[model samples]
Target: MNISDQLSITAKGNPSKTAYIFQGEKTSYMELEGAVTKFASSLKELGYEKGDHIALVSGNSPYYVIGLYGALRLGLTVIPINPIYTVEEMRYILKNGDVKGVITMDLFMDKFVALASDFPEIHHYIVGDTGADVSHAQKLLNDKMKSFTGLMRTAELSLERPTIDDEDVAIILYTSGTTGKPKGAMLTHKNVYSNAKDVADYLKYSPEDKVIATLPMFHVFCFTVALNAPLMNGGTVLILPRFSPEDVFKVAKDEKATVFAGVPTMYNYLLQGGEAHKTDFESIRLCISGGASMPVALLKQFEQAFQVIVSEGYGLSEASPVTCFNPLDRPRKAGSIGQNIWNVENKVVDELGDEVPVGEVGELVVRGPNVMKGYYKLPEETAVSLRDGWLYTGDMAKVDEEGYFYIVDRKKDMILVGGYNVYPREVEEVLYQHPNVTEVAVVGAPDPNLGEAVQAFVVVNDTITEDQLLDYCREHLAKYKLPTVIEFLDELPKNTTGKILRKNLRDRVTQ
Candidate 1:
């Protein structure tokens, strides 16, 4: 079943229950359903039918929830974009995904104005007011613009819903392009709903649970775990715009939030807070750590300080984002990603697709309903990723005899900085655009707080300051993908075929 149907079922069962609490406002299940129905009807009136694509570009808020479910209700594919992305990055996704409309805050109206000419295919620009004057935004957007609040208020609460197949695409998530440009991973309705149900079952979510939604809603981890899973199971969500140690503690105590999910950096920050011990985290029953490997020391320390158990799990954007979560019934493993959940099957295979010995390292492959259909509009890439019935995850991992899996390294040379994926090639491509750079290589460096940091080694013909190069990157790259360290090298290490040896550069950083 589609997520929209699951939400309707929950609302019917618990009409008076609180669906989500944003800031100080609480929206009941009945109210959320009404708003979603109204928004869906409004979109239909504007000629948005099934199989159309719309982009949701905003931070975590009630607006995000309404837009997401509304689009899904009409069988429209939702492309969730990071609100902080550079204009160029946003343009690439909108142009590549063939987006027909955009749902974004008024603060980002200027960026859309700059990109309007580049992509004339985008017909509708729905602007939500986050303290910005809607009248001024409408003036800039012209007749094509529509106020988000206006649609909700004027539209009727009735829609002729489309018959959405289970295999139809629901979300087209763009992975941080390891090759060069980001490729969209198409997640079907079944892929998303199955993963959410499995994750909710594995985590033991119940109606009485109140989950903290501090992680970015755009990311798959938070989208499935902190938002979809709870709402599907008739639980309440406490929304936060951004992550702040002070804000998290206050919300957890005041709202009595039971489940908190975050990356390792967040846990480290909370542990470093001087008043962590005194903070009333007693209401929290479970803590989830994902997006990156949790350092054992930080995990142990945080549990001691807060008197709560932090269960670590593993997932990627392609697998509807979750494959394994530490089982709640068993003794939790410290470093493992736990075992494969529910109907999913995960195994380590060698170069020839043969299963390796239990303790040997190999590429991790997964097969299940949760795996994505394929990359959008890239048949060759999809064929390589999905061979036979299994999705070949490019992660080097080993499984113990007890079936617990440990990720050893990334075969794709990916860097996980503060739980966000940063590809070396994506950063290298941006640096190559500079005229002064003759050659360049980017690698992951050891970081104390972020787990890993981006470092660049350059061989340049002309003089260029690090600040100057960094200023250029800020225009094209996100803040998390910026290189923290820049080293001047005469020439990069290379093999006989003239391929830059990235392993050597990574070793140099560690040394």
Candidate 2:
């Protein structure tokens, strides 16, 4: 069944259960379903039919959830965009995805007003209420503008539902590619629903589980694990507007949240002042880490300070963002992403698509119902990524005899120094072992002698000289793998989801 139908079943069984709690406001399942129906009906009345594409650009809010399910309920493909993206980035997706309508917050009305003249094919501009006065923008938009709040309040919930198939595209998630324009990954209904169900089952979510949603919903990691998994299992979701150490701590204590998910950078932040708030996460049983590799040192420190189990997983946007998670029943591995979950199959393959021996690093590949059908409007790129029914993930990984998988680094991010393969993650892992080091990232720097030299970027809590760090690394890393230059930063450049932007670091070296 599609996600909307699954939500309907949960609502019918527990109408009064709290579906989500946002900004101290509680929304019951019945109320949430009612709003989704009304919003879908209003879109139908506005001439938006099945298979139409709509862009949802907003931060974490109840309106974001409503707009997502509302569009999916009517069999329309929803393209979620980061609200902080520039006009150029936003325009690329809208124009390339062939979006027919847009649902955004009133705060961004001015941006739509600027682009309306260029995008005449976009028929509807539905703006959600953010308490901003959009009078001038509305006047500019004229007949094309529609109020998000007004549509749900006035529209009836009697619109006919479309027959959505499992193979039908539901979401077109754009990947944050390092090199060129982003590629949109078209996920089918089965791909989304199956991943959510498998994740909920693997994590052992139930009606009593209250999953914290602090990660950005626009990203696939939070979309499936934090938001969709809980709802699919009739659980409560605590949605924080943004990720902050104080806010997350307060909400976890007040609401007794059972599960919390975040990236490695967030885990580092929580560890900075986490000792005082140890009791704040007493009710939390599980902490999930993804988006980037969790430093083994950081993971152990956070787990000890908070006294909670943190499971690190691996996924990409093309696979509904989840394929493997550390098993809760077994002794959790520190650096491993754990075995493949449920129906998904993960293997490490060499360049020729042959499975490599255990304990050898190779490109990771995945095959399952969760993998996307293909990239939207990019057949050549899609063929390169997806071949023989298996999605060839560009991540370099290795598996253990026990079937646990460990991500080494991105294939493209691997550095070649004097013809010897030098993976940055291997060096970063050594640097993270320092007591004063908080976060670290390594990249290749241009060099005339060794062809390319290893460079390190580090964020530390206390004073540490380049000589001391290099001396410490000499004991662990090989002479060829040692970094020639070390640059200290207050914080690393990261994307919206907090993954370290190695590409940006590489660009800095070239400049």
Candidate 3:
């Protein structure tokens, strides 16, 4: 079934119940259903055809949710982008995705305005919590459907758009490629809806369950587990624009949220200065960690502090993001990421694509409904990742005798800061733009709170203070992508072949 059907089902269950709680705005499920119907009619009136790409770049708000499902009802590909990206990155994505329209807030207008020079195809631009001309404003706010309330009201919702099955692409997610560019993963509607069902089933969430939607909606974890899972289950999702540890705890306590989903850094920060006693988590039934690995020590600390168990899960962007998770009813191993989720058949395979013993570390492979169709436009990379309908995750891991999986290391040099994926090469590229440094190499260092941090080693050509380079990095990199640790060395490690060895740098610092 199409995901928007959940809206109709939920509106029938408890139409007046609060569906979202932002900082100042609150909308009931019935009101949310109304907003979605109105917006879908507005989109149709504005000449938005089925299968057109609609980009959403906004802070955490109810607007993101309404915009997303409204497009899905119309069978449009929703491309969610990080508002923290540099202009160059945004430009590349806009052009590559062939976006027909965009919904954005006013704070970051400069980048899109610059992009407007080259992107004339984006004819429909709707500003949310921002300003636009009268025509654009009326086009968005105008509700042409006088009596329609749900997906059923919109007859123009294109049920005949070439028979949209579960395999039809619904969301296009961009991941930092190993080749120094971004690759878009084409996630089918079946991939996401099934994954959300698996999540809701694993977590045992119900209609009364209130999930704190703190993760950015752009990320797959937020898309499937945090947002869509709750929506599909007719649960309440409280939206927060960004992540703040103090505020997250307060929201959990205020809203009496039953499910608290977060990354490692948020968990660590909650543990560092606050007393997360049983009272603070009185209503919390489940605590989930994803987007990165949760250290064994931190997991234990959180459980001990709050007197609640944390189930650490694992996934990738290409797999609609929810592949495996520890069940609440079963025994949970500390270091294991848990058993395969839903219809997924998981195994650890060696370099030759052969299965390895339970004790040895190898690449993790999964065969499931959650696996994405392929990369949007890159067929060669997609072929390399998919074999016999199994997705080969480049994460070095192992399964124990009892079928519990543990991640030993990452096959790629990616850093996880707060919950954001900061590719080392991406940060290094920004450092190269600096005129003061002669050479720069960014590597992931073991961090206590964040799973890992982006650390930069530089060889200076002129007199430049560390603060100056940091300021420059702040200007280019996103808040979480900025290097937290900086050091100066005479030169970088190089092998006889003159290729810089990142392993040498990581070892020299840690050891």
Candidate 4:
């Protein structure tokens, strides 16, 4: 079945139920289904045939959802782009993905207009006006330009979904190019739908659940967990424009949100918000954590402060973004990504692709229906990632005797200090234990004497000297693992998903 069929089924059972709540505005299941159908019909009228590529670049909004589901409903491959990308950055994705059209917000109108002339393949432009005025230069482009709202209203509603095979590619999610240029991971309809359904089932999602959709939908984690899983389960999604600890807490308490999902950085920020800014998370039944590993200290602190339990999971963009999550029915392990979810299998293996013994650190490999079809137009990269049947995640991890997986760090992020391997996450975990440290990211900086030295970038909640923080790390970490330098900043850099950008820290320090 098509992914859009989830809405139709939910609407049939709960037509009047709230499907999405954005900025206090409510859209019922039936209404959302109608909008998606109308928008899909409109795209069809523009001659966007099945298997064509259409890009959707925008922040969290109702229009983004409509565009996403509409494209999927008609079997068009949706390319999700971060709206903040520069003209050059977006141009690369559009050209690489072979995008035939784009649906972007008015905020990005200028960028598109500037780059439109370079790509004649993009024939249609649907602009979502988020209270932003459009540019007058729309007449310059050869493509037809129309407001997204206008199309949704004028197009005839076609409840009939186009024939979409389960194996048809649905979304092409580009990776955050920390290592090199980004490559799009082609997620098929079955790949996404299977993961969403399994995620909803694993999390014990019910129709009564109200999920906080704070993470950007462009990323696979939020696309499947916060958006697709909730929709598939007939739950309500409370949409937030962006992640703000204060705003998230207020909305959770005000809207009575039952489930909240976010990354470690968000959790640290929420913890740093302290008692004064703390919202009664009494309304939240369960909190989900991903994008990055949650520091064990921060996880415990937040649980105590907010009076809620947070289950952390692990996955990359290539695996339909979810391979393992802490099961709701079992005892949630503190730092473990938990066992593999239903129908998914995970193993920690060495360089030879053979599984290591329990408690041995190695690469995490996953195999399941949820795995992506392959990387778009990059067969060599796809072959490297997908071997035999398992997708090598390139994440250093270990599984306990109970089969709970613990992410050690990204293999590329491991530091070689004086020929001794040091995982940045181990040092960051020590730094997080400090009373004053709110957030920390560790990286390797060039050191003539020792090959490489450990340097830490930290965000502190209290007035603490760098020396003192380093001294605290010294006490907890081994001599080799201790950070040699500590730099205090107001905040650490993060991606749209709130994952701490360690590569950025290394770049700053090396410069």
Candidate 5:
């Protein structure tokens, strides 16, 4: 079945139910579905049809949601882009995907206007007003740009849903490209629908649930968990334009939200912020953490402070963004990504593809319907990644006797100290245990004597010297695993999705 059908079914089942709450405005399911129909009709009237690529670039807002579901309804391939992308970054993806049109916020009009000549493939541009004063740039963009509201107003309310195959590509998600250029992962309709359904079932979401949507919609983690899962289950979503601690707490309290999905950095900020302690988060029954490994220490602290159950899951863009999640009914292990979700098989394997022994670290691999069809237009790269019905994830992990999985480090991120191999996550875990340490990232640096030396950058909340922090690590870690140098920072560099950029840290010394 097509993923867009889920929204239609939900709307038909409960037309009057609150579907989305954005910035104090509420939209019912019937109203949302009607908007999607009009927008889809608009695209069809403009000569855009099924299988055409349409790029959507905006932060968390009602416009992003409507554009996404509308494009899906017409069977168009939706390319979700980060709103803050630079001109060069935007050009590469748009060119690679051969995008026919784009629906973006007015904030990025200039970037599109500047590159309009270079990219002749883009035939349409629909800019959302976003309640911002962008009139100054309207004159420059008037030649080719169309207003999103104007299109909806001019189009009819009915749309004929396109006949879609289960394997048809629905989205082209570009990887963050830590090592090289970003490769677009072609996710099918079945891939997204299966993951969203399975995750909602695992979490036991109900129509009464109100989920907090703080993460950006462009990222797969939030797209599936926060947006797709809740809407498919007929639950309401509370969307925040940008993550402000005050705004998040206010919505949770005011709306009595049940589920909240976020990255580890957001949780760290919530714990340090003053509102978290005073605010009543009792309404929040479950919290999901992904996009990065939640430090075990931080997870425990967050649970204790908010009195909510937090489940940590693991995923990559190629796997429809979800593979494992800590089970709710079972014992929630600390730092474990939990067992494989429904309809997915996972194993830790060696270089020869043989299953590794329990507790032995190896590359984690997965096989499931949730896996992507392949990388778009990159057959060589796709063949190397997807092999014999298995997707080889470049994460180093170990499965316990209880079947829970613990991520060690990225395969390429492993550090070799002399002849010993050291995993950065192990050292980062020890650093997180320190009470004063707010956030910490460990990476390997070049050394004259050794091949690589372990170095850590830390953010602190209270008084702590570098020697003291290093001594703390020394007491808990072995000589080789300890950080040779500790650098203090106000915060770690992260992408729009809140995943720490270890590659950026490595570039500091070499650059």
Candidate 6:
């Protein structure tokens, strides 16, 4: 079923129940459905035909969900852009996707208008909020956009959902590339629906569950796993437009959120939020971690402190993102991404594409309902990623005899130091074991003796010296897996996706 139908189902069952809570404003499922149908009509009024590319550039907002479901309801392609992206980055996306129109916020209007000078393909620019008079706004959503309260006024929408098959592309989510020109993953409706179902099922979400929306709506992690999954299960979502560790606890406690989804850094921040011990966080029953591997030490400490275990999962942009996750309602696997989900088949293979024996490190490839249709307009890249219906995820991992999978690191991010391959993730894992090491990233530095020396950029929790960290890692991990050179950094460079841009970190250090 289409996502709009899911929202409709929830509206029928729980019309008065809060579907989304953001900035003290709540929108019921029925209200959210009415808003979406109105916006879909607005798109129709603007001559947005089905399959037309609708580009959205905004942070996580109640309107973000409205635009997303509205566009999909009309059978249009929704391309979500990172709100932090510069006009140059957005230009490539606008022109590349041949976007017909945009549904952006007041804050992004100026930057978008600047790109319009170069991108002639873009036509309509619909501004969302009534707070500002944005340029080229077809109309403003007014009070509904302002407070997310009131009646859903009908817009006399005539736009019919375009006849789309399971294989038809729904969203073009751009990711990867060092040049900052993102590669768009063309995900089909079936892909998103399947992944959402798998994750919702794995997490055992119910109508009674209230989820915290920490991750950005643009990111696939939130779109499929958090947003879509909760909607599919008819659960209430407490949306956070921007993350504030202090506010997370307050919102969770106030909204009585049951399921909380977060990245490793967010989890760390929440731990350091101070009221963690005092604040009763028992409302949060299931916590899921994605975007990066959860540090074992952090995960263990989190469980001890919060009385909730974090189920670490792994995915990238190509698999419509959710491939493997730690299964709920089963025996937990510490430091592992648990088993492959219900509709996905995961296996580790060597250079020859043959399955490696259990416990041997190999590239994790998956065949699943969640796999994307292809990379938008990039046949060669699509061919490389999808071979015989399996997406070759660049992540390298290993499986145990009990079918538990452990992700070693990103294949390209693997550092070969001292002629002995040292997976940075392995070293980082050890560094995380140190109580004082809050965040750490391992990268290969130019070394004359060893060709490439392992260097660690660490963000310490306490006053721990480099020697102390190395000694701690040495105890937990092998010598070769330990960092040879350690430097304390305020923070490591990361992309919008939260993946460490090791190349950028290296550039900063070398320059």
User: Which candidate should be chosen as best, given lDDT against the real structure?
Assistant: 2
Q: Estimate TM-scores for all models.
A: 0.82, 0.99, 0.77, 0.97, 0.98, 0.93
Displacement of the residue 326 alpha carbon in candidate 4, Å: 1.1
Let me know the TM-score candidate 4 reaches against the reference structure: 0.97
Model 2 alpha-carbon miss at residue 494, Å: 0.9
lDDT, candidate 6, at 26: 84
What is the overall TM-score of model 1 with all chains considered together? 0.82
What's the lDDT for candidate 2? Answer: 0.94
Residue-level error in angstroms, candidate 6, position 345 = 0.9
Q: Provide C-alpha RMSD values for all models, in order.
A: 10.6, 0.8, 10.8, 1.5, 1.3, 3.2
Quantify all predictions' global Cα lDDT against the true fold: 0.87, 0.94, 0.77, 0.89, 0.90, 0.80
lDDT of 2 at 98: 99
Instruction: Enumerate residue pairs that collide in model 1.
Output: none
Per-residue lDDT of 1-511 in model 5, one digit per residue for the tens? 7557888899999999999998789999999999999999999988899999999998899889999999999999999999898999999999998899999988788788778788777887898986766665566555467889999999999987789999999999999878788999999999999999998888888899999999999999989999998988999999988887778888988999899899999988888884444455779989899998899999998888887889999999999889999999977999999999999989999999999999999999999989999999999999989988999999999999989999999999999999899999999999999999989999999988999999999999899999999889889999999888999998899998778999999988556
Runs in model 4 lying further than 4 Å from the true structure: 277-279
- Backbone clashes counted, model 4: 0
Candidate 3, position 403, lDDT: 84
Select the stronger candidate by lDDT from 2 and 4.
Answer: 2
Model 4 is weakest, by summed lDDT over 10 consecutive residues, at 134-143
Candidate 6 residue-wise lDDT, 1-511, digit = tens: 6677778788888899888888889889888887888788777766788889988877788778988998888888999988788888888888898898877777776686566557556666666563766534223322112212221244753445567677778899898566456789998888888888778887888889988887888988888777999988888888988787777788888888898888888888778774544355778888889988888888888888888878888887778788888877786888899888888899999988899999999999999888888888899988998988788988899999978899998887787767788888878887887778888888777777877778899898678787887777778876766778899988877776466778887775566
**Top TM-score: which candidate number?**
2
Could you tell me how far off, in angstroms, the CA of residue 70 lies in candidate 3 after the best superposition? 0.4
Ranked by TM-score from best down, the candidates are 2, 5, 4, 6, 1, 3
State how far residue 230 of model 5 sits from its true place (Å). 0.5
Model 4: per-residue Cα lDDT over 1-511, one tens digit each: 7569878899988899999999999999999999999999999888888999999998899988999999888889999999888898898999999999999888888888888779877888898987776656467763478889988879997745678889999999999988888999999999999999999999999889999998998888889999999999999999998999878988888889999999888887787775885565878999999999999999999999887899999888998889999988878999899999999999999999999999999999999999999999999999999999999999999999888999998999898988899999899888888888888899999999998999998888789898888778777888999888898898888777788888888899889
